[model samples]
Target: MSGLVVHSARKVDADGLVDDFWFVADDGVIIATGTGIGWHAAAQGPGRDVVDAGGHWLTPGFIDLHCHGGGGHPFDDGPEEMLEALATHRAHGTTRSLVSHVANPLASLRESLSIVADLVAVDPLILGSHLEGPFLAPSRRGAHDGAFLRDPGPEMVEELIGAARGTMRVATIAPELPNALESIGVLIEAGVVVSVGHTDADYDQAARAFEVGARMLGHAFNAMNGIHHRAPGPIIAAFENPDVTLELIVDGLHVHPKVAKLAFTAAPGRVALVTDAMAAAGAHDGDYRLGGLNVTVRDGLAVLSGTSTIAGSTLTQDVALRNAVTLVGLDPVHAVAALTHTPAHALGEDHRLGRLHAGYAADAVILDHDWTVRRVFADGVPSADPHCTPARFRMRYSFCQAGLFAYAYR
Candidate 1:
């Protein structure tokens, strides 16, 4: 494609926000970004479409590292469902995501991996697969099928890894399981990011997992132990480990805002805001299935039929960003980073997927003054239909420069 110029917006970079700026992108790569009227005047050229931001916020596109499903579809269903779920998220500003699947039978897991691998071959927006279970602690396997939970033994781990065919980006496991440490070694060696989650592991065990090459905390504090004076728990261990990136579900129901603020303050840029959203994320309140488990969505909250335990969130990345700023008291810049750059870094795709830097894909979300999505662009093309409406297109771009195009329009 040809170059496009986004002018007259308040630009936000990795460092901070700037005003009176213009950004240029050509063939899906950001070519130039500068502030002041001179840059805007210099940017005028033939065949360059200019989008006026009207002084609204301009940041990088959001990324989600841990999301199960959306748009009334679950990831465990198959490629069609996975694609449908991803489309729901993409309309809400998530340009790239890792297809997360819950615990299931080995054959089912293999099939899911194969489907994801095939999708990745043609869709770069599907970062990879996030195996969220089958190697987790049953006691803490919140929404995952406990019947399928198993120890991450060498053979089973190798089998699952091989099934991914090098397309698996992350796997969540309990650190205290048998051979879990060894499995971490194997997974890290295979270039997969290991995340500590769904476990009864205390401080020491969680710390050991981090020491053993686990670099992420899945939905921190939801499926794990809490912080205590003596124990400190996995949350503290994650906070203390600078290399670890903590995932937080900021839907106000999954976690208290005060606690979420504490996590943001404790981890700083290491916090990655994610939507552990299930099948009912973008749908109306009704019956749904998550990982073969019956779930009911009432009052926009997804829960087990008879229990208060949150099955998943009815959230999208745009709402997560709004909550991060308004509810969690996070700065807009850091909030955007948590939703975009941090998760991209976690998946080891920062070079091509996150931020608005040159050579990155032209995936973007345009928002209004109130942070509502107005327009969404995936792979340098505007999404055919967006999920929400805003006053105007404020600047927010999420790019995945690879060959895959997997964004959805509501």
Candidate 2:
């Protein structure tokens, strides 16, 4: 790869704002960063490529830890479909993402994990895979097919780990299931990040999961117990634990703005803003399905066709960032970190992925004053033109296999 320098920008990252900031990237990593006219001297020499941002809002590229699909495709499909699914999200500034799979037959789930492992070999942007299923509470199996839900038995856990081939990043489990604690230990031993979700577990039950090494509250306050005066619930249990990262879907549909703000305040830097979007995210609102369940998308809200149960959402990280700032009343620095740094830390990649400092990956997003994505870069190369029009494929049964915990019947 060639060298890249983005100059004349107002950069906001972990170190906060820097006026007229400029950075240099060579061989796919940030080499230098400073404020002022130093870039002029660097550009004076040959073999240097530079971009005049004209004072756009620069931020680290958004990292989404929990997303099923976007565009008109879902992650459960093959590689071509996975890339198609991410095109809309990539244009909207999500430079790195984890492919999440919903519940399925054990054999099918193993195949999905191996597929992600292969993709990761070619695309570092494909961080890994996140399993959101097969071990959740049936009572709270929001969109997941109840038939696929099972106990997190040790043998079953080993089967998934072997299939992922070291690329399984996270697995969401309901802690109340029988033998769940032992399964959590086995998953942790294999270096998988465990998350508690889609459960009827109370505060103490959820707390026990956390103590056993589950570090995330999967899409907090949803598919789980709600907080009451006497019952603090799982979300409260997450808040009380400093090591926990609270995943908040700030789409205004899944979580209220006030409630989202409360999470930011309670968890502070521990909140990760995720878009639990399915195939309709950046596509037209219409008929769709998630994992064999018919879904209707009206006004961008996706729900099971015959019921009020939300299947997933039609959201992208750009809209999520805009909402975090405009609706939730958060500072740009904090809001941006929620999208970038927090999630990176949750996945234990903060050393190189989330910050815009020297030695970090040259991943960044240039935003307009209103927070809309204008340009994006990953590994020193600019993405295709931000004015992207995704090819609308005919919605089919294969496309509906978009996965997330609490999905539909298969």
TM-score leader: 2
User: Each prediction's Cα lDDT score?
Assistant: 0.82, 0.87
Over the stretch 251-291, how does candidate 1's per-residue lDDT look in tens digits?
Answer: 99989999999998899888898999998987789998988
**Runs with alpha carbons beyond 4 Å of true place in candidate 1:** 37-47, 388-410
Whole-structure CA lDDT of model 1: 0.82
**lDDT, candidate 2, 90-195, per-residue tens:** 8788889999988988888899998788767666778999999999999999988898999999999999999999999999999999999999999999999999
- Best by the lDDT measure: 2
Error of 1 at 72 (Å): 1.1
Error of 1 at 53 (Å): 1.8
| TM-scores of the candidates in the order shown | 0.92, 0.94
What lDDT does candidate 1 reach at residue 184?
A: 95
- Cα miss at 6, model 2 (Å)? 0.5
